[model samples]
Target: MEATLSVIGGRWKGVVLFHLLKGKKRFGELRRHLPNCTQRMLTLQLRELEEDGLVKRTVFPEIPPRVEYELTPFGRSVEPILVGMRDWGEKYKARL
Candidate 1:
């Protein structure tokens, strides 16, 4: 649907969401997961996801400070779709 696409569509957004599906991740961890994505691209995609209300960002006040990203319940609603896509992609690759 156009609505879904508008929120999740993009070169890096889906990938970022996929990683977040595993659990909360710090920014550095996400960067490690998506090494090919430029930091700027990832930051932009995360900002959009946050603005869309599908992702949550938490900032902890500490000596060094901490930040983490996790999916909102609304975001988790897409898990089945994302999981299906992942499964299909695996099968398709195997068939190649």
Candidate 2:
């Protein structure tokens, strides 16, 4: 529904979550994985996901600083949904 779409419907949000499903990743790592997304847009999407309580951000105290993003317990609940979407997409692609 509308609520779910509102949280993950953006062009980059779902992609971001999909990457996070693999494991926690740093800002740079995420940027590399989603090469098409600009840094600013990625940052914005991450903030939104964090605000929605679906993504957790951890900041480490270091000279250069380190930050990592991972899914919250609630967020993990969506894994099956994303996997289903992935499966459906694969099927659709095959049909084509």
Candidate 3:
């Protein structure tokens, strides 16, 4: 659907969600996973995901502060779709 696509349509969004599937991660961890994505772009994509109710961002109060990202229950609903995409990609890769 158009609405659904809009939320996860960007190049980095789906990738971001994919990494979050494993569990919560810090900003640095996400950057390590998506090395090509600029810090600014990653920040923007994460903000959008948070707004869409697919991702949750938490900030801890402490020296240097800690932040983490994890998928919300609503976001977990997309697990099947991501898994399907991964399966399809593998098949397509083999064909090519």
Candidate 4:
């Protein structure tokens, strides 16, 4: 449990993972999704997730290079947990 939290416990890490579960997203898209998160903080969180081997960063060579973020196979393994959390939160929120 500690290990799982260590990797995904950051303020926005799990949220990032949850969004990525939907599909690959560009940096701008992620920023839009996490509007409350500071750009620097999100950047830091992404770097940490990438370092932990849960997310993959791909850069395309182009005039205006494109970068996209998606989950690695290992990252996809956390789908159940993220989904469960989302479900539970929804239920809990409804109760309030």
Compare the candidates by lDDT and give the number of the best one: 4
lDDT of 3 by residue, 9-84 (tens): 8799999999999999999999999999999999999999999999999999988999999999999999998888
**Model 3: per-residue Cα lDDT at residue 16:** 95
Tens digits of lDDT, candidate 4, 1-96: 999999999779999999999999999999999999999999999999999999999999987999999999999999999999999999999999
* Model 1 ranges with Cα > 4 A deviation: none
Better of 1 and 4 by lDDT: 4
lDDT of 1 at 22: 92
lDDT of 4 at 8: 98
- Which pairs clash inside model 1? none
Q: Give the TM-score of each candidate.
A: 0.92, 0.95, 0.96, 0.96
TM-score of candidate 2 versus the correct structure, residues matched by position = 0.95
Error of 4 at 87 (Å): 0.7
- In candidate 3, how many Å is residue 39 off? 0.3
**Candidate 2 ranges with C-alpha deviation above 4 Å:** none
Where in model 3 is the C-alpha error above 4 Å? Answer: none
Per-residue lDDT of model 2, residues 1-96, tens digit only: 999999988899888899999999999999999999999999999999999999999999998999999999988888988898889999999999
Off by more than 4 A, model 4: none
lDDT of 3 at 46: 99
lDDT score for candidate 3 against the true structure: 0.95
lDDT of 1 by residue, 1-90 (tens): 899899988888888889999999999999998999999989999999999998999999986999999999998988888888889999
